[model samples]
Target: MALYGKLETEVEIKASAEKFHEILHQKLHHISNASSDKIKSCELHEGEWGKVGSILYFTYVHDGKVSVAKDLIEAVDEENNSFTWKVLEGDILEHYKSFRIRVKSIPKDEGSVIHFTLEYEKLHEGIPDSHSLLQLCADISKDIEAYLMGNNNEGSFIAKA
Candidate 1:
């Protein structure tokens, strides 16, 4: 059996770690301009928002295609301003066994680090590396930062009222 590895990417945001974390944890419908379509329709499946063990379900569109994913809140640390999620089920499972996102604050700065990790099962020998997924995560991070910083004027992915 092939042991799929995890891929991660991090970026610093221009908003306070608390603000960013809060926005990230809030109900998915609240975000007016998310970068990824998958994230735009996200909603808590059970329990309160940001609570560990809560499940979030959402439909995601990638490459003009749409699919669904159910993810569990793996961890949440308010003190460190970090949270993590693991995929419980999803359309992407054919190629991936699990995926996670972690966000942590940087001390002495109004910024935080957003990290994304994915563990995939090789579907074929031709399966390419997860660089595109990582880039997608980076784009999502940037969109979140822009939304929190009040710069998403055009209204792309985040929901608008």
Candidate 2:
């Protein structure tokens, strides 16, 4: 088996694309409030919150386990409503030599469609693809959309931190 793998998933959201992008790129710290069960906390570790090359620390639940990740903001494209994050250190590093995630929200007629992509180089061929993680991304997207649309009771607290 190949050591490199990529996974992609998309979710249809009734929320505005710009608002969704702003939440992920600019106000990421508020994600914990929106998806309290999946993401425990997201905090800025170094540099600005939304700027490229900044570092962010995330404490989240995945596959029944609570894990921590330090990620670098690799790129942000406002025109495309997309951003890329490279994992610098985390539970993910244990299974993959390198991992990166890119997210983009495309505006549709009704609302928008959010896409998530995970690219990784595994330490070994035995390592499974990151399907579950991609699923988590989709779930989080739905949770955020619900919060943004005022359909979910989850907090929509956007932080300046």
Candidate 3:
């Protein structure tokens, strides 16, 4: 039987929900600058940015090693400030049969709560679950928030599983 799993994490951002959500959809490319430690670059590979079905290419560092991914913007829920990304090609595909990520930014009185979900099906039983990836997402969330708040935290925060 194939092994399937879901990993989730929540990060609190000290920025407004609407602003944070807008950055996620409108200024995705800037995310690399926001979380330089985790992501080396994020570029538009195909289609228009901020639109459904748009493709984004990412080069990132995870578990102290550099990796790359091609992700499809599968869905965008503006009303709820949610986005879904489907991984088409990448190092992650080497171990997982399929991988998908969903992120939702919920409004809060002070700021926003960023919720991340990673869903994957392992190619084999030997592949461990993606706890490191989930932690990277959480760290990146805080980095982006700091960037939006005019605080550049370059190299100050390190990600670990």
lDDT agreement with native, every candidate = 0.67, 0.92, 0.87
Error of 2 at 118 (Å): 0.4
> Over 4 Å off in model 1, which ranges?
36-38, 107-110, 120-126, 153-161
Worst 10 residues of 3 by lDDT: 152-161
lDDT of 2 at 34: 83
- True-vs-predicted CA distance for residue 161, candidate 2, Å: 22
Instruction: Estimate the lDDT of model 1.
Output: 0.67
| Cα lDDT, model 1, residue 8 | 69
TM-score versus the correct structure, for each prediction = 0.78, 0.95, 0.91
Using TM-score, give the best candidate's number: 2
Q: Which ten residues in a row have the lowest lDDT in candidate 2?
A: 152-161
Cα-based lDDT at residue 157, candidate 1: 37
Task: Estimate, for each residue in 71-119, the C-alpha lDDT of model 2 and write its tens digit.
Answer: 9999999999999999999999999999999999999998899999999
Candidate 2: RMSD to truth: 2.6
Clash count (model 1, backbone only): 7
Tell me the lDDT of model 1 at 133: 63
